[model samples]
Target: MKKFLATLTASSMLLLAACGQEGEKSGASTSGGGGGSGDKVIEVWHIETGEREKYFENVATQFEKANPGTDIKLLRIPNDAFKQKLSVAMSGGNPPDVFQSWGGGWLKNFVEQGSVTDITEQVDAAQFHKNAIANTTFDDKVYGVPLGISTNLVFYNKEIFAKYNLEEPKTWDEFVNVIETLKKNDIIPLSLANKTKWPGAYYLMDITSRLAGPELFESAFKRTGRGFDDPAYVEAGKYIQDLVKMDAFNPGFNGLPYDEGGSRQLLYTGQAAMINTTNSFINNIRAEAPEFEEKLGFFPFPSLPGGKGEMTHVPANTGPVFSVSTKAEEPKLAAEFLNLMTTKENAQIYTDTTGSLTAVNDAAPNDETMKPIYDYLATATHMQMPYDQTLPPELAEVHKDTTQALFGLSMTPEEAAKQMEAKAKEMLDK
Candidate 1:
């Protein structure tokens, strides 16, 4: 099964590479001069492509205009290649001035190694969401500026809910009732694309939040407790299997590809009642089925009965953070660019283009369809970063692989927990 998954991923990457080659200048490119006239060239690296890349370029152009004698060199890399390239550059003492980061253990490693600079004074923490700032901060010092916030929740079709007389569920039991009702009505209860694995992992993330609360995961991440072997972790896997047993996901869900619109297609056509995904999904729905946007309703993950997790706790994280390298030629200019990029005006430009949640305070998109997300965030008691981002890379991969296997019914919940614990222990012991 692992070999099969590897083949699938490689094939996908090959196809992506082919597409990227055809659109050479668009998806990835480097822009800047060699060196001349004592000009300060601040190199910036990012993984966003298409309109997102364009947005960053426009902002860079704006910053250059605002600050003469400093060239903001932009290097756009494909997501698959960006991380490796950045790691190599950083380790080789030639890192970019600013680069994309998903803050957590990943950023902490750079922080501890002194590859990234501490920008505590340059940033005003109060200008961003607490969760965003927290994600980028380490040891009481800020290392990066958050670009956006992402929350995973159940997005439902309002028309389907109204037809079935279902209200937004507050508890796990009520959530199950909605699922059963949808299934009885011959509608797919949920739309999922597990081909990439991470989409399916969201289920385990939300369930774990409900079953064990944030402290258990944090303690485990900090290497203080049972780690992934905790009973709560096992129980979260059981809930995922429970959903699988109930036929909660669409047919061929495990085989579907998210980037290819397999799952969003189901919801757009009303074949599925709901989809568990993040704010990034909004762009897909709008592009595929613009008319259906009005029917989309966002709700927080329902709480579990007698659970230690707060109902207000959410599985969320800020999107890619922009961090300056400690080895930059012009650290001050790079720092200034970071500030320029995160200003309310520029942040809103990102929110407007992507329909995603921005990290800048009061910068949430004003679209009515996105209002529910903001409303939920306003009262959220906690923001649990996605496990794949918060956990060490090796353990994170194990989490994804095990959760996918659980979804496929190839492994029991307890077995999945044991596998995760074993991997966590092996990695930490090394």
Candidate 2:
């Protein structure tokens, strides 16, 4: 939906257009800036496409003006191609001076490989949220600056709830009951953005933690030596299957693109009562349909009975991470850019524009889109990284594919969990 600039291919438009490119991956298509910056350029790459691209581009321009001697070579790429291009750059010893990375699975590989420079000493840990800091830390070392922090919150259509006289669910049974009631009334209970693999996996992660607490998913996925197909993960899968059987998900979920699947639009259109998405959906809805804000409200995902997880506990993680290359020539300038870029002002700009929450303690959410995330982050008793981000790439992708299959009724909950375990073993054993 919203992309950051660090995912770019470092391509210059003029160069690419002239090549009349046939099979030649014309354009810079790599790195953030031109090397040997005659003017000391710091290359920054991300996937800030759509309207938000201009916002961050402005942030870069501001930084350059503030620092005078510094210039940021900004490249914005498509999300699907970012990781592949980033890998090529890092392996070739010409990584961008600063780039966008987060969601632990991606960051960890580079951090472990020493491809990224550690910003711990330069960054004040006290200035950031502990939950975010924890996500970016490895081997007790902080490897990246959390670009933002986010918490999962359930978004419900107030009009639908009032029309049905339904209260926001507080526990698993009530949540299921609510879904059933909505289905019986000929309404979709949930708007799911499963067309993209991550959204389906998002639901699994949400329930697994609430059903089994953060410990199970965290331990299992994070290689804490715990089993992946435990009762908790299985039980969560079953719940997902139960909802699927009731036909609770919005129509066209599997067919629609992530943003278009109506996960963000359903509540706006009253086609679905609620959506399982990040706080960013709040902003998306407002921009897509402003009147929906009056009809929208949010709640933390309810906890299952007899679970260690709190009803208030949410799926949370560092919003995004910013890191620099270990081979950068302008290291101090990069640090200054990082420092200047994360101040409450810049954080506010990015968060306000993207509907993300700042990791910095003093930065208050300026937009209503992030209000729910902020509320949960401030009040939740506990939070955990999503299973996808907590686990290695292979395990995380397994969760993604299996979770989507389970919702599509192609796999039973127990079968999904068992397969997850098999996959985990296969990957971890090596």
Candidate 3:
């Protein structure tokens, strides 16, 4: 369980080191494409590999073929490596023409540094969902185009629920009862792997949204009226601890990983009744346990009584936001490539090939398993970006770490909330 340590501070340090140095020019060829005369090359860096990498390559080839004398260089980097490499590139003042981003506080840093280009005029904002566009926009200016949208949901084994004569819960009390019933039946109520830390964060995030609503959470993160030490966050952590006391998650969940023979395996083997994870887990079910796919169903996080948030306010955000660099050799052409990537045709291809929802308004999944997700996003009033993506990198790490501690019973809810507030004030109060 190696932690990914490429934080905003690491990138800022690199930026400081490279300052006043004559770094290589932006859009310069590093590996791909031939430097032929009179050719316009748009270098794009992304963290897509395997089948998804092939999709990007195909798009580049198509774009190249359609526009002669233009080269679309695709640099596919692994997830962990991409963060470090992209940070170094940004700091060195030679960023790619188009690059992948998560488009919250991460992109906001680059935008504030003038490292990213604003394509608000060129991009048709009306073509995307408001939530998708909202993630990429800063200070009322659009800095990127979102490729797809993703959200967290509770995926349950319908067969297990049927065996216990249980139905999906709509309220917190009902959800707790469902958990107690599963526990009594000797079923693990939730399959959570928190070794990487982010998995456990979903609980606190969803609970906070339900209890305090999005406004208070936003204000806390932004260091406005309320702060992270608010009773709401502590209450959310207490709720998670209550679940822990109920033996809701698999044994040694904090030591388990999400991939391979871990929490997901528990669900596949029918040892676990449910898993609260992102919609992407649907793909895992299809790939790893096709037989279990039929038994899988999903539902929104149950609402809390007297909560300020609506059930429609989901914990979600755009998948991968692509932005053109301000240092791009051909800024207009770079913008064009981004536009091409999200077009209805390419978006449909993205959806069909990836089994995920694209940010394009017209492109949606037609499958029975995925249609509910599409419907959820269609009606969602607020798509709350994950804390790890929305908060500054350092603060985000504290969040994950504290949430993991909460799940492990290593820290009290009040202690965790205070720690988070202390860090938030140090980082955000300036």
Candidate 4:
């Protein structure tokens, strides 16, 4: 980090003095540089933080240095705070040149409002991963570049598993049996906190697809006049409630803040046996206890007992992306900065340092916790983008709320099913 910074600090001082006269005449933020386009600056914003924060800042600094005539500024916001800030900024017509975004139906609203620059032609489609790129497209036009990608991971503690002589589960029945066995031994089957709402919905999204199969969810989401209460979703929800009834999740898991339940800490301390989380958690584990580097293991969401979809059915997404805004002054510079930030070298570096999965097909996972999920996707007969991304924003929020209520044992499969059906119909009436 220090080495990376030293080179940047040294070059800027000299670049500044030489460009002083040019800076005034050229109209660019940096006199002679700024991509030879003159005064415009490339401003990039994102919510990547912690180990990933350095990763982003390092890339921005390098992009500026590599293309010396250019001035690039990166703002890394805390994730918890980004959504609110981004909304306000974009509404005021002061959106950043490029910023991280998920490829959800919400993006449709952004695209329709002309808030994001369509980069379909600016970037080489062939260079980006096909699956990653596919998710970002709307009405056959692309608007963003891939920054990072991730998959849901089943993380288990090795020492705890070894002590219990537990074999990692490969199938859904096996997984349920293991949970039952663990319960018999007085271990909380797993740590889950539905109070955070989205986590519960995400779990339902990932696992229900495992039980009900992909086509059902896709069909329901695609809106051929059907809705979320489809038989498959109800069955899946029932299965979820079954898990809840087993007293499976930790006591008061419904009340715990998803992240603060010390859920990751649970795996680290052997207090809990497993956590179903994004591969990103691997880095947190490594940071909390270095020895876990060897103890950490991963498994995919298992195949359903009687479902048609193979165990290879996995949920995946380009974690988020940076889109150029139409209101921005520096279109060319924004494109240039986008290219630099997502260069495979930097992408791999960030993945390595933060234990993240990259969006590149050729990039290797930073660690073992993600390998199984990646391997499954490579051969997956079917992979679904998470429903949150696939569904309209209004409908997605309903699912989130319903899933949250379900986990609290307040909404049954039938009731949740009815709520979703009403929502889909309400939206379809448009």
lDDT of 4 by residue, 232-295 (tens): 6788787788888887777777667654534665666666777777666765655567787688
Clashing pairs in 1: none
**TM-score, cand. 4:** 0.85
Q: What's each prediction's clash count?
A: 0, 20, 0, 8
Q: Candidate 1: what lDDT?
A: 0.83
* lDDT, model 3: 0.85
User: Which digits, one per residue and each the tens of the lDDT, describe model 3 over residues 226-325?
Assistant: 9999999999999999999989999999988665449999999999999999887766666677798789888999999888989989998676789999
Candidate 1: segments with Cα more than 4 A from true spot? 1-39, 49-51, 73-95
Candidate 3 vs. true structure, TM-score: 0.86
Alpha-carbon lDDT, every model: 0.83, 0.74, 0.85, 0.72
Name the candidate that leads on lDDT. 3
User: Which residue runs of candidate 3 sit more than 4 Å off their true CA positions?
Assistant: 1-40, 49-51, 259-261
All candidates in order of lDDT, best leading: 3, 1, 2, 4
